[model samples]
Target: MSLPKSNLQKIIQVSCAIIVSEDRKILVTQRSASMSLPLKWEFPGGKIEKEESPEQTIVREIKEELNIEISMSNKLPSVTHHYENFSIILIPFICKIEHGEIKLSEHQAFRWLNPNKLLDLDWAEADIPVAQYYLQTLNK
Candidate 1:
């Protein structure tokens, strides 16, 4: 029998920001053509660097990638997915923009989408479960 994904020897830890607006829309970004998983849409955040907590990573990444500061509101359930060559555990947090206008620097495109319509885009595999969980939370 194969090992459970959690038992994988090299699982990567990634942080995700679910930037929600007062109107219930969430920010989403599409990967640049030169990035891995090119063209797949994902939430704005990045890999957790050494010595940085998931929270710190999101704050720093959002500023660097979108030029905005955000306040974390809640922690969503984390999702783990196995790709062809690796696996990742995505830790998601609900966030609100604290200041500054967004100016995308790493993504090819971005959108403010109603939560219900998020699945309409082609999402990176790791984000699929996180999006589903976020949507389910809205129904409860």
Candidate 2:
């Protein structure tokens, strides 16, 4: 089934980060119990605000959500996903932590896991492709 015209026109663009640590682990955050899609693991990120570039969105979101600074390294393929009530264009970028300890304000938990182990968690649907791409291209 397809969405109605009104709903189809309401796609949200989100900027997501695939943060890699010095030890080669990828960072993942769990949604807080009160948040939409609660407790699902996902790459930490947020919706892009008006007039903001995806890169800027990621930088700002990481600071606000994780309380850490990141330097974007590369842009990954973007994924668009549809749900019952909405759709999202997930733009992912590779980033490295530049400063500060992570202090989660919106997430319930966080983990640094090997790329190969990313699928072990119960991931949010929109982030599955991002994880798969990382695993497939890790050595490239």
Candidate 3:
């Protein structure tokens, strides 16, 4: 039997950053073991709050999750992926670290990897497309 509309999965919107360093490396974070997709690497950011724009969401998420400030540059293509239980739209922006050091609050670890090396890590399924896009567009 088909599920009720209320029981259907919802599409979540998340704002992520492709944080570029002075040397042009991209920042990726590993999910905490307690998190749903534990130990998988993904770009740093979080779900958008109500009334928040994608830009605002990314800035706030970076501050909250990484304790660093970032200057946003251009936006990349958004990725939408579906899992068995839910779907998510990943909104990614190109950004540079503006200030502060990396401090992990919710993540297990962080890495600054060459864009070409991004695929070497085990990534969250939703974030794979983002990494591939960055590699294809920016790493060329």
lDDT score of model 2? 0.94
Residue range 1-140, candidate 3, lDDT tens digits: 99988678889999999999999999999999999788999999999999999999999999999999999988999999987788999999999999999999999999999887999999999999998888888645
TM-score winner between candidates 1 and 3? 3
TM-score, candidate number 2:
0.94
Instruction: Show model 1 residue runs off by greater than 4 Å.
Output: 1-9
| lDDT on C-alpha atoms for all candidate structures | 0.94, 0.94, 0.93
Each candidate structure's TM-score, on Cα atoms with residue i matched to residue i, is 0.92, 0.94, 0.93
| Candidate 1: tens digits of C-alpha lDDT, residues 17-125 | 9999988899999999999899999998998999999999999999999999999989998888888778899999999999999999999999999987999999999
**RMSD vs true structure, all candidates:** 3.0, 2.3, 2.1
The total of clashing pairs for model 1 equals: 0
